[model samples]
Target: MEARVEVSPEQEARRIAAVRRYDILDTPPDGAFDRIAALAARLFDVPVATVTIVDTDRVWFKAAYGLAGVTQVGRDPGLSTSAILTDGPLVVPDTLQDPLARDHTLVTGETRARFYAAAPIVTRDGHRLGTVDVMDTRPRRTTPEQAGALADLAALVMDELELRLTALRMLRVERELVVVEHAARERAERDRAEIAAYAATLQRTLLPPALPEVPGLEAACHYTTASVRDVGGDFYDVFPLGTGRWAFFLGDVSGRGAPAAALTSLIRYTLRSTALLQPDPCAVLRALNAALLSESADGSRFCTLIFGTLVPHPAGGFAITLTGGGHLPAYRLHPARRDGPSQALARAEPVSLPGGMLVGALRQADFTSRPVRLLPGQALFLYSDGLIEARTSRGARFGEESLAAHLTHHAATNRALGAAAIIDDLTVLLDSFAAGPADDVALLALSAATATPTTAPSGASGTAHTSLPLPARHSM
Candidate 1:
């Protein structure tokens, strides 16, 4: 009678489940597994080596070396199956002579394997999934070193399965992240476009629709914003105060965007109201300084301003008194004089005011006025720091010296340089010097009319002479 083969149904069920979890049965030969199997055959001096996964009724070869065209064999209660069942290494020398393999086909059939050794491919959870096994037709015994090598090779096969699972998980996560990033970028682009449009509209409302015409005077103004997406801090306006007197102010706030724009509007309206109440250039500036200081509790906001009162003189010219609050000095361009037979020359005189503290910065601010005469055929130019701070392509600054040279050249060429002509020439010069301006530029040019006009300068001619409402007082 044949010896009965023992089997444990519960343990066998779990072992089969672990083998299926790897999904390695009946798969095409992989280079990694094939290479290890070939190395095993060479190391053990065997005719055949295989990476075998035991199934329910048969054993499947994932990788085979030195074997004929066979992919699978019956799972007899033999060496390879014993390695899987016991979850350990098994070695049988002369399988035909061994009781464990006496009735096995591998020993009784044509492919009579006399020797067999195998190591279990165990998972971290102690589940034996498969085996790395070597077989030979002649009887042989395995050294302890050879047995350990077979066990090491089996562990390496399990590592390859773990790596494949990890790579697949990472690939899935990367794909999901790409989808999320694309959606976020699209939403941000839409928001940016809407913000740019709103900023442009707000910028237009803050500036004068057109420059006001002053009686007996010709005035022009220009504003260049550094970017269309953001509002600038620079502002300028020319409006009548009352009683044959006119007020004009130009200033630059501390920063850019909506906050700076709000401050610009406040400064502009405050100057108009204060000029009407006091009319004195120094007094008007003092009132503005007080208002600014009260408003800027955080101390981050301030401005440099040049405020002036234009009174018609009994003589031909206008008596202009101006107060400066940490602003650049104004320039008076004189008419050209014939120097020689061919050359003509002109001069740019600096109209300097006593230095005062910046508006919106101090509890108490000091301001002073200097009286100047603006005659016919001569022009007065007021500009923000942006004009002088511009840079050339070669990184040279268009400083005070360069500005003075430009003014002198234009005055010499056009002996009677009007306000309009000065603004036009300066705009061209700035554009040529810098392809893109680094900051906002505000320019205001005033000149006495050379020829007497029939109509008095009024709001109809882009100049406003109406009394403006006083700004409402607010708690800082």
Candidate 2:
């Protein structure tokens, strides 16, 4: 005879719902749960121990020890199912003698469990989810101390499940954060690329399209930007001002990037417009100074410039008048004797101009001009401060004295080098001086043609000269 086990549908439904909430069904075995089960079996001296969750129709083992190749067992009115219904430990001493276990399948079938002891796995809300159970093939009984240890092991299993759930939630949050950061980085890169493209186009518009053909002279110019992502402050132009006269200017604004580019465009147009109206070097600079001062109310903007005008001289070459507004002095490269050996030692001399205050600083700006002669076989070199301020690998500044020495050396070696060749050689030298230039450099060279008389082209001034196409822009 066996004692009947009562079943309550409402309580069983609530227990099943709480078990499902944990979402541990059909999960792989964990080392923590396995250790608990093994410890329970050893403490109770049983051959089978399992950490089981009681489901709707079966008892699933999350971890099992001493059960050979068994992961689950049916819950057809068995002792494990009865443990799920209890709030505390359920101990069956000698299942063959106890009325509740005498006819159970675990006792009569191949397992032949004669003893059973289980501690219910209960939630904080007082719902039973499963059991930590120990069983034996031979009839036995559980001591009071052994039952208490089994109950402690059941509590440990629940703690392990809570840790696993916390870890899974943290991993999900970390993955989502990684995805968002990657998207933000991509968007930033695209925005920088677009800004660079726009800056490049605007920089081109600020310079002249081409150097106009100056009669009785050879001209060449080069511009280098320190960065393509931001516009540079250096600018230059050589354009015809009408009536066989031409105006040329080279300047550097106070800063770099889009703000400087905007001001550069304004200065360029202002200079062109002012020069056409006055046609005098000093007068043109005064007009520019007034314009810049008017625009810079916050005292944040200014420019250093050298403006010049060229006209063919009746005596021999072109007569040049230059006005400086706190700008670097220009250099005149004189060739060796034309009647003597073709490669005589050449000379370089600084063409000094009257120094004035920086443009846009004062309302009554004072500007002065100096007259210079560019005879045949002579050239004038104008450059921005970037050339003299460039640094070498050893961190020493390449000052004006070093530049003068280099110019003298090149002229002594290459007597036939024209304005274009001089610019090319200087550019190569600058590149070799540093790994990369850290500032914007602008170079312009104008040379009077040699005394060889040749036929001029149709509809052109009676002067013979050759021109070369401009080189591509370089971005540091």
lDDT of each: 0.74, 0.74
lDDT of 2 by residue, 78-151 (tens): 58778866657888878887676777777887778888889988887777778998989877776766676677
TM-score, prediction 2: 0.56
Model 1 CA deviation exceeding 4 Å by range: 1-186, 338-344, 451-476
Most TM-score-accurate candidate: 2
TM-score of 1: 0.55
Task: Pick out the ten consecutive residues of candidate 1 with the lowest summed lDDT.
Answer: 467-476
- C-alpha RMSD values across all candidates: 35.6, 35.7
Clashing pairs in 2: 3-99
